[model samples]
Target: MVDILILLPIISIMIGLYFITLGLWELREGVNRHQYIKYMFTGLFLLFILTPLVWMMVNVLL
Candidate 1:
């Protein structure tokens, strides 16, 4: 339990980065295909990347 808690933030940050990378990749694919929905996905993934940071900040602030 303690180990899981210690690693949670690190794991989440890594997952967030992964999503950001995927978002960028999808953005490129969208541009190549000239699709608008890809922009939405890109935005979503970017938001996901920020989620962990935001969560950490809020926890710290509170």
Candidate 2:
């Protein structure tokens, strides 16, 4: 149980990084095509990626 708790945050961070990479890839295409909505969605995707890390931090700190 303790090991799982420690590992959970690491796993979440890895998943978040993956999403960020995906979002950036999409962002590049959006930039090339001058698509506004894609930019917004990509930004949202990046924000969503931050959620897990933020949650972990809050839990640890408080």
TM-score of each model, paired residue for residue = 0.50, 0.49
TM-score of 1: 0.50
Clashing pairs in 2: none
**Model 2 weakest 10-residue run by lDDT:** 31-40
Cα lDDT tens digits, model 1, 1-62, are 55655566666666656655665676677655434345445545545655566567656655
Error of 1 at 2 (Å): 1.0
Model 2 / residue 7 / CA error / Å: 0.2
**Segments of candidate 2 deviating more than 4 angstroms:** 31-62
Q: Local error of candidate 1 at 55, Å? A: 8.2
Q: Pick the candidate with the highest lDDT.
A: 2
Please write out the lDDT profile of model 2 over residues 1-62, one tens digit for every residue: 56666666666566656655666776677655445445545545545655566567657865
Query: Could you tell me how far off, in angstroms, the CA of residue 38 lies in candidate 2 after the best superposition?
Result: 8.9
- Model 2, position 39, has a per-residue lDDT of 50
lDDT computed for candidate 2 = 0.59
Instruction: Give candidate 1's error at residue 15 in angstroms.
Output: 0.5
